[model samples]
Target: MKKIRKKAFEPIDKEEKELMESIERDEWRPVKNIDQEKKKAMAAARNTLRKDKRINLRLTQKDYHQIQIKAIEEGIPYQTLISSIVHKYLNGSLTPRS
Candidate 1:
């Protein structure tokens, strides 16, 4: 009759198991620089206070080209000219006479 040998069972080590458990329970916190956060918040607040207004108007391509040409001739920006025109109209400097 042949004798059968039993295999030895090894238990898990306590220190290694606790280390893994600690790693699993670790919480992740975002790393943020205080100065960067402050700058971002300030920029956001400024943008919120600075509103962009737009208007829709119809103009011929030739008229737009002419305005651009005139602005270039006067060494001024087209949008600056438009803003000045609008301001003048609002302040009664430019009046329409019929």
Candidate 2:
């Protein structure tokens, strides 16, 4: 058993004070079945991933090098950059001015 100290006055912000008051009043409680809820969320995410399709494409050396450099600057794999560009173009959101 741990012994807690009671203070006459302690300065805390509104959110912290509210949280402490709720804890002191036993207003907070744990979920009855947390594992089941987490499993459901994981299953939903897996289902979304499973719907994705894979594709392969051949590119010229110049185009591939440019794509690789651009992908490096964007901090993503070249394949992922290509996928994002294709997706954006298909959705009519990627507009090339030049």
Instruction: Report the lDDT tens digits of candidate 1 across residue range 20-41.
Output: 5665578445557978989999
Model 2: runs farther than 4 Å from truth?
A: 1-51, 96-98
> Lowest summed lDDT over 10 consecutive residues: which window, candidate 1?
3-12
| TM-score of predicted structure 1 | 0.42
lDDT of 2 by residue, 1-98 (tens): 99987966774798888888888899988878999989998999999567378777989999999999999999999988998898788888998788
Worst 10 residues of 2 by lDDT: 48-57
Model 2, residue 87: C-alpha shift (Å): 0.6
Candidates in order have lDDT scores of: 0.77, 0.88
Candidate 1's displacement at residue 3, Å, is 99
Residue 93 C-alpha lDDT in model 2: 99
Q: List the candidates' TM-scores in order.
A: 0.42, 0.47
Give the top-scoring candidate (lDDT): 2
